[model samples]
Target: MGGFKATLINEIEKLYKKKKIIVAAALALIFIIVGQLATIALRNGFGVRTVGSMEFPILVLSVVANTIIPLFAALITIDSFSGEFSQNTMKISLTRPVTRFKFFTAKLTAIILFVFLNLMFVMVFSVLAGLIFNSNTLTAYGIIRIFISYIVTIFPMIILVMMIIFFSNLINSGIGVFFLSIIVFLGFKVLGILFSDYSGIFFTSMLDWYNLWIMSVFPFIKILREFLLLCSYGIILFTGGFYLFDKKNF
Candidate 1:
């Protein structure tokens, strides 16, 4: 347990040292500010009142999930997994007393922590933006709903992380891993669009799970089904990554 904790700490420290978290936070802030400004313009200038400040976080999340999150996931996974191999640093860690499983767990935990922090920043910033611009009074219920939405968002993100990590474990080239993951993500999105009837099979479709929170009538069954699909994909990709990592030659 102590070894795993140490590894986790080391992984997180490395992420900070590399400025991954800093970059992510900056991007989140910029995207939120720009998106909120555009939304405000549309609402007041163009009379598109459908876009509210309260909905800012949701809009930012939906847009980032499709664009920024996937790219970040691929880059982070490649840096954590494949970049070490490319730089010959992975062998040093492999020679250490820590088990491969513990090392892998630490890296995965770090990635998830980074993503969670980014999500928190988006939510907090969105709330602040809403208050400043939209005169949105923060209510206890609104706060609870934001937290719930964050939790729901985690499901799809886990699947994305696992998928990228799976590719990273398979490919030693960091750039190759990144491009392959992006291609796969885009392919899944295309598949979802072309086969809307079978959208359940595409993990990309689950990325829009935020809609469940925004809907007037919550479709519990659809949410449950999408949640299950994400879990299934997450499990498969994680297992594949573990198997590949264990069998991989250092």
Candidate 2:
């Protein structure tokens, strides 16, 4: 147990050591800044009050959670699983005393941690942009809702990470896994739009599980159902990815 603890920490440390994560954050910040500027232009120039101050965070989250974060999650997963293999870091890490499951778990947790930190990074900036530029920073309730929205958003994104990890294990090359994920993601998106009635079954549709996606008043039952669905996907993907990881020749 203690060994696993150390491994998890070390794995997360390795993830943070990457320069790509830093660059990703910078890009996200730029997106948020641009969003704020656009929103300001619409309000002041066109008198089009489309978005308010309190709603900025939720708006930013909806855009990024589905696009930027998922894209980065795929990139991180590809780097973590495939890049390590190509670089032969996986072989060196496995040579340690840690078990396969422990190493996989640590890597998985670290990727999830990266997702969360990315959310926090975006959340903070979005909130500041809102409060500074947009009018009417509302009550504590609004803040709580923003916090919950961002927190709950972590689930679907984690499932996205797992899905990419499964791909990472099956494909030998990092670039192959990445391109395959993009193709599949686009395919799922198109399928969901075409088969709108059956959209719930599509992984891309599940990204809309964030509370404020469309609902003015979210139901507890609906939330629970989607939460369970995401959990099921996460379990299946993790198992399949781990199976491949365990059987890989290195």
> What TM-score do all the candidates reach, one by one?
0.92, 0.95
lDDT of each: 0.80, 0.86
Model 2 scores worst on lDDT over the 10 consecutive residues at 207-216
- What shift in Å separates residue 19 of candidate 2 from its native position after superposition? 1.2
Which candidate gets the maximum lDDT versus the true structure? 2
lDDT of 1 by residue, 1-250 (tens): 8889988998898887876667777887888888778877888898887555556666777777777666676677789888887888888877767898898888998998877777777888977887688775556766676677766787788788988889888877888887888788889888889989998788888877777875779898988888777778877888899899999887
Query: What lDDT is reached at residue 16 by model 2?
Result: 89
**In model 1, where do residues sit more than 4 Å from their true spots?**
136-138
Q: Report model 2's TM-score to 2 decimal places.
A: 0.95
- lDDT string, candidate 2, 7-113, tens digits: 89988888888887998799899999999999889888999867777789999998998788888888888988999999998998888788999989989999999
Error of 2 at 40 (Å): 1.1
